[model samples]
Target: LAKTTQPISMDSYEGQEVNITCSHNNIATNDYITWYQQFPSQGPRFIIQGYKTKVTNEVASLFIPADRKSSTLSLPRVSLSDTAVYYCLVGVGTGANNLFFGTGTRLTVIP
Candidate 1:
């Protein structure tokens, strides 16, 4: 299990592109980077995952370098509704027991 470090908070205005980077210096070869977004009183939802290079979905894009020790989650043209806590998780693909919770990056979207 690799520990993730992210900013304590971030602020962005509506219609802005936000990129949140996470650092995992102790990542393992079998580890993958996974990102999640959570709203108030709700569980975290999977945003994206990647091993290397770039992976994109309807909502966000994930970028991983060849070293695989760090990742960036990119949200395009965010709105006020996009404000939430974002988490970066680094670990092998296992069951729930392998998951570790850490302080997430609080993203505030302003109008």
Candidate 2:
């Protein structure tokens, strides 16, 4: 498993764009970058993922550089509801149960 590095915390106002970056220098070629959001007392939910280049979904966008050494998660027009702990992971496994967990980036969205 590759280790990911993220900010300890972040702050933002409502209707703002929030970008969280994760670093994984030892990532394998088959590994994919995945981000998850977890609220208090709840399991983390998948946000976005990508192997290389970029991937976007309804909630966020994932940008992966050519080296796959790092990735950034972008959230547009965030609200207080988006406040949560965001985690970044690098792995080739599929399914929620197969994913590994680590300390995540805590995002605080203010009104």
Candidate 3:
């Protein structure tokens, strides 16, 4: 397990797209870079994952450069309900390991 840094907060209007970037300079070889979204009073929902290059799924797209030092999460056409905390995580391969949720980017979707 390792630590990551992200913006404390971001504000945007409803229906606007939101992009959150996270940094993980100390990522290990066996580690996977993953993104999660969390709303108040709820658990995080896995958004995307990338070892390198880019990965896109139904929820979000993850962009990772060759260095793997940083990644971006893109949420398309977000609504007010999308306002939540976005977390970038570096995790081991163990599927059941508890994730250490750190301070993340708080996205505020305004009307």
The models' CA-based lDDT, in order, is 0.89, 0.88, 0.83
Candidate 3, residues 1-111, lDDT tens digits: the string is 467889999999877778888888777787788888899999998888889998989877888888888888888888888899998888776743535456889999889
Ranking of predictions according to lDDT:
1, 2, 3
Q: What is the lDDT of candidate 1?
A: 0.89
Superposed model 3: Cα runs more than 4 Å off: 94-100
Task: Tell me the lDDT of candidate 2.
Answer: 0.88
**Prediction-by-prediction clash tally:** 0, 0, 0
Q: Flag the better candidate by TM-score, 1 or 2.
A: 1
Tens digits of per-residue lDDT, candidate 1, 23-100, equal 998888888889999999999999898889999999999999888878999999999989999999888866554465
Better of 1 and 3 by TM-score: 1
Model 1 segments beyond 4 Å from truth?
A: 94-98
Worst 10 contiguous positions by lDDT, candidate 2: 93-102
Ranking by TM-score: 1, 2, 3
Candidate 1's clash total is 0
lDDT of 2 by residue, 33-111 (tens): 8898999999989888899998998888999999988899999999999999999987775644435555789999999
